[model samples]
Target: MMPTIVFGVLSVIIIGFALAMVLSKNLVHSAIFMAATFVGVAGIYLTLSAGFLAAVQILIYVGAISILMVFGVMLTRRGDISASNLFNKRIISGVVVSAALFIILGRLILTSEWFPSSFSVPESTVGPIADLMMNAYVIPFETAALILLAAMVGAIILAKGARRTR
Candidate 1:
């Protein structure tokens, strides 16, 4: 009952924010809407008892990616943050392709057997997963973090260089 209500609310939030993110003219506003969409996805994960996924959604998507995008928009001196032309001459073709793809995917989804007849939800916990990440996957995790750090530093340098020229 409560889960259903939560799911419905989060679904609405996710869809609304996703649409807003896509439709928003201002880049910053779009980033904010994207963050909201991430949060809504995290909420959905929580309702589904996927604690690790929820946390990752919040931390990685909302916290890191969204912040990086917002910073990128703010630091760059572009012509206009708000896009003037929302659609191009190829919009008709794009829409046709999108609709066809959607129909194909929808048909596949409706026909596929997602789970076995005797399938049961397995119990999950975050503790063992965290332990494994910190132990077995530590090197890979650290490497990824370093890569992100390098990208951020590069972005900062580019922004500073651009600022000096202007």
Candidate 2:
């Protein structure tokens, strides 16, 4: 009962903030709402016993993406944000497509019979998983960092280019 209540609250908060993000006229406010939505998702992860995923979600989404979006908005826009009619042409189409996908996935989930794992992972396995990620997956992790670095550098160069042209 407690779990259901917690999940229900988290779901409501997540959906509310997602709607707020979409409807917000102010870019900064939308970014804030996006962060709130991300945090709410992390809470949901926590409720599901995915502590590592929750930590990563908070670290990456709230720490990185939220800041990056705000910086992008600040860099690109001037003056108060206004509601956009950008979705006018394709809104119905998008909704139809998304609803179709949702229905298909819901059907798959409902029809599938999932079996529980036979073996339980020891608490001690967590440390080894972390170690493996830090060591074996270090290259991919560093590559991701490099990609972020490249993006930052590209943004800087583009900003400088724009300033010089002005």
Q: Which segments of candidate 2 are over 4 A away from where they belong? A: 84-89, 115-126
Q: Which ten residues in a row have the lowest lDDT in candidate 2?
A: 79-88
* Per-model CA lDDT versus the true structure: 0.85, 0.85
Clashing pairs in 2: none
Can you write out model 2's per-residue Cα lDDT over 1-166, one digit (the tens) per residue?
9999999999999999997887676777889899999999999988766677788999999999999988988877866556431344666787799789989998999999999668765555357667877999999988989999999999899989999999
Best by TM-score: 2
Error of 2 at 133 (Å): 1.9
Q: What's the lDDT of the predicted structure labeled candidate 2?
A: 0.85
Per-residue CA lDDT of model 1 for 3-77, tens digit only, reads 889899999999899878876777789899999999999998887677888999999999999999889778754
lDDT of 2 at 57: 93
